[model samples]
Target: MYMNTLRKRSFQIYADHIRPYKGRVFLSWIFLLFAQIIGLVPPLLYKRFVNILSSGTSMDTDISMLVRIILLVVVVYIVMNICYRIAEYVVVHYVARIMADLNQTCFAYLHRHSHQFFSNNFAGALVKKVNRFVNSFRVLFDSFYWDLHGVVVRIIVATCVLAFLNIWLGVILFVWSILFIFVAFLFIKKKLVWDVQKADQDSVVTGVLADTIANETNVKFFVGSSREYARFETETRTQQYLQERSWMVNYWLNVAQGVLLLLVEFCMMYYAVQLWRQGLLTIGDFVLIQSYMFAIIAHVWDVSHIMRRLYEGFADAEEMAEIFETPHEIVDVKRATTLVVPRGEIVFDDVSFQYHATRTIIEQFNLTILPGQRVALVGHSGAGKSTIVKLLLRSHDVTAGKLMIDNQKISHVTLESLWQHVSYVPQDPILFHRTLMENIRYGKPDATDEEVMEAARLAHAHEFIESFPEKYDTYVGERGVKLSGGERQRVAIARAILKNSPILILDEATSSLDSESERLIQDALQNLMKKKTVIVVAHRLSTVMSMDRILVIEEGKIVEDGSHKQLLRKKNGFYKKLWNIQAGTFIM
Candidate 1:
């Protein structure tokens, strides 16, 4: 039942993509039918030529007629080839366009899924699915047009021609062809199960390899290369096993088909001989039966393989079809309006959130930040500080209650519009494998190069960036592994500074910097924060000392809210204790 559903889904995906080009597809099919019909004429002409030659006339006496027959055969073949080429050209041209569209469509749909969906699936697996989905379309279409469609047309034409010449011969070919296809389909049904399994295992192998490569540094640091190798070997071995099992099924199917074809060939030829001896069949009839028999047998043999290719294509496409069918976890509301954050005021009214229903992270959390206020959230690790920031960014929607920005509900606005007004610098910054200039300019795509350099100067990132031989053009390795932790953070800070959005979020953004770098960045941030509403999630007590207000959070709830000086005056308060520990001036 599941396989049946998947088959429908796979074809539907193909249909949707091809619907716009249906006219071209219909035209291609017309050309293909004409080509197949043209291909059948040569076999009939051969039978006629053989009968003429056997009419007891000397070669010299019938030389002109023989020459005419040969010339006609050659003309028929040339026309057949021309039609085949035209059909092929048309099919390939449209299939290429369709495949490219499918690739882009798959990528666009996959990206629309919420953050949670990405968290659950491996990136490598997702990439493989997209490639397979696109490539499988090509495989299935070619098989249908060149192999399956051609074979069907050939069989129908050959059967009709033979039945016209000899009814018994046509009946024998038609019934045997049906039996051959029916048996092949039964094998295909069983092989399809293995094909789907093999496809899934292939994805697993790819995911395992990607995961290992992505974490190559970790494996090297811990000297766990052997362990990773063993893990990868296990996955590959399973893949090999599934591949072999699938191939074995195909092998057995060919064996069964071969036996069927041999029996039919013997029965038909023996019957043809008996009719010839009884004067019921002409020598021409014998030649036609043999020629058509061989043609049908060859085409029938291809049916098993074509069925296998079709099902294999379906198996590959089904994986991505499932992803397309999954609804996006986050979507804009109907008639969603743009988020205009002129004041940058944020309000979290009676908000609550949980990754899972069994364990709540934040419960009934309520807070409001006035426009242009520099509010700091200080808490121990896992105290929901980052969660609060993510909520404000709408990375995950609130489980309950309303989160608004400048009087407009965040959920009521388009996600792109909401994100446009905010600049976020995460604790661990990830950079694309591109030039530093490109990475920095990501904050404001249309920013002038001069503006980018100025932003880098403000974030104190210009010194190291200029030292590289390539300067701003130096490529950052994957995830910016080429840069130190401090350098990546500075680049991230520079990006945020260049953005100059109405609201800024720094979740331990300065944590990775050295003391001197941090001091310089603090100075830069002060200027950047002049009129923007700033929310800082910091563990370091010294960073929040100058904030307008500091909220101490513990276990997902606000434990204290006051200025840094006021919080320090409370001798045993959570903020005060944190301050004392960081300052190394414990009161105990």
Candidate 2:
């Protein structure tokens, strides 16, 4: 029953992708069917030629007819081949288009999932699933069109032709073909479990390898290459074992199918010999029966293989189908509208959140920031400062209460619009493997080259960028690994500056830079902060001293709220103690 559901889902996915190209699919099917029908004519012609030669009379007349028959055979073969070529061309063309569409559709759906979903799944495994989905469609199309469809058509045509000649022989062939297919189907159903398990193990191996490669630097730094190799080897061995077991099942299935074919061949031939001895069959009839019997056996054998391939295709496609059926954790409301942020005011009205039921990250959180207010959230690690920023970004919906921007509930507005009005610079910035100019331009895709350069200059990123041989054209490598930590941060700052939205967020933005570089960036940040509502999440006390307000958070609550001097005046206050601890380090 579970397999039946998976099979239906697999077909549904394929149908949805091919629906737009139904005309092309139909045309291809027609050509293939025409070719299969044309293929049946050759054996009948051969039988006629054999019978004519066997009759012992009229040599001269017979010679001329034999020549004509040979020429006709050549013509038939040429036409049949032409039809086959055309059918193949049409199938290839449409399958290519369908595979491309399937790839894009899967990629788009995978990315639309919530951030938490991505965190739970491996990037490499997801990629493998998508590729398998597209490739399985191609496998299914080939198996059906070239093997299953062709075999079925040939068997039907051969049975009809034989039945016309002799009823008993036709019945024998048709009944045996049906039995062969039924047995093959049973074996295929049984093997599908192993095929799916193998595919899953293959994905696990791929995920482990990708993880190791992505974290190669960390592995090398810790001198754990051997440990990683041992882990990868274990996964590879499991994948290998599953693959071998699946192959053994296929071998056993082939042995069973061969036995069935042998039984049918012997029965048909023995019956033919008995009829010939009784003077009810001639040499021509014998040849025809022999020809059709072999043809039927060949097709039935192909049926066994085709069924195996079809089931394998289903197994591969089911993995991706499962992903497609999963509901998106975040989705816009039916009537959601664009967010309009006229004044950069943000409000958290009695909000609460939790990752899981047992532990609450933020509870009864309430805060209101006026337009153009510069607020800093000072907290120790896991104090919910980062979670607050994430909630504002709508990465996860709140468990209770409301988060609004500019008098509009965020959940009621489009995510794109909300994101468009806010700019964020994270503590650790990850850049694409692209040129510096392109990376900065990602902030505003339509921005001119001049505008990008100007933003880079404002972030104090221009000096180091110009030092590279390619200047702004240099590739940053994956996640900006080629650049220093400070360099990547500057590029991120440049991107945010280029965005120039009404609200700016800096999450320990200057943490990566040296004191000198930090001071220079601080100047640029001051210029950028004017007339903008800025929210900074900082651990360093010096960075928050100039802000209009400081909220010292502890255990998801605001323990102290005041300016630098007001918090210092309080005896043994949380903010004061934190400031004292960090002040000595800053001075040193």
Highest lDDT against the true fold, candidate: 1
lDDT of 2 by residue, 1-588 (tens): 776777798898889888988888888788788888888887787777888898886999889888988999899889888888887888788889999989998988997898889888888999999998899999998898788888889889989988887788889999999998998888777777788998888889999999989899999999999999999999999888888887887788899888998899899889888988998777778777888788778888888788888888888898898887788987788899999988999999999999966789999999999999999999899999989998998889999999999899999998889899999999999999999999999999999999999999999999999999999999999889999999999999999999999999999999999888888888889988989999999998888888999998888889889888899999989888898888876633
Clashing pairs in 2: none
Q: What is the TM-score of candidate 1?
A: 0.96
Q: Provide TM-scores for the models.
A: 0.96, 0.96
Q: Model 2: which ten-residue window has the lowest total lDDT? A: 579-588
What TM-score should be assigned to candidate 2? Answer: 0.96
Residue-level lDDT of model 1, residues 1-588, one tens digit each, is: 877777788899899989989998998888889978987887777777877788888878667777888899899889888877887788778888999999899988987788789989999999999999999999899888789988889789988987886788788888999999999999898888888998998898898889989998899999999998998899889888888888888888888998998899898989888888898877777777887787778888989989999999999999998887788988899999999987999999999998877779999999999999999999899999999998988778899999999999999999999889999999999999999999999999999999999999999999999999999999999999999999999999999999999999999998998888888888899999999999999988778889999999999999999999999999889998888778862111
Each candidate: RMSD: 2.2, 1.7
Instruction: State the displacement of the C-alpha of residue 324, model 1, in Å, after optimal TM-score superposition.
Output: 0.8
- Please count the clashing residue pairs in each candidate, in the order shown: 0, 0
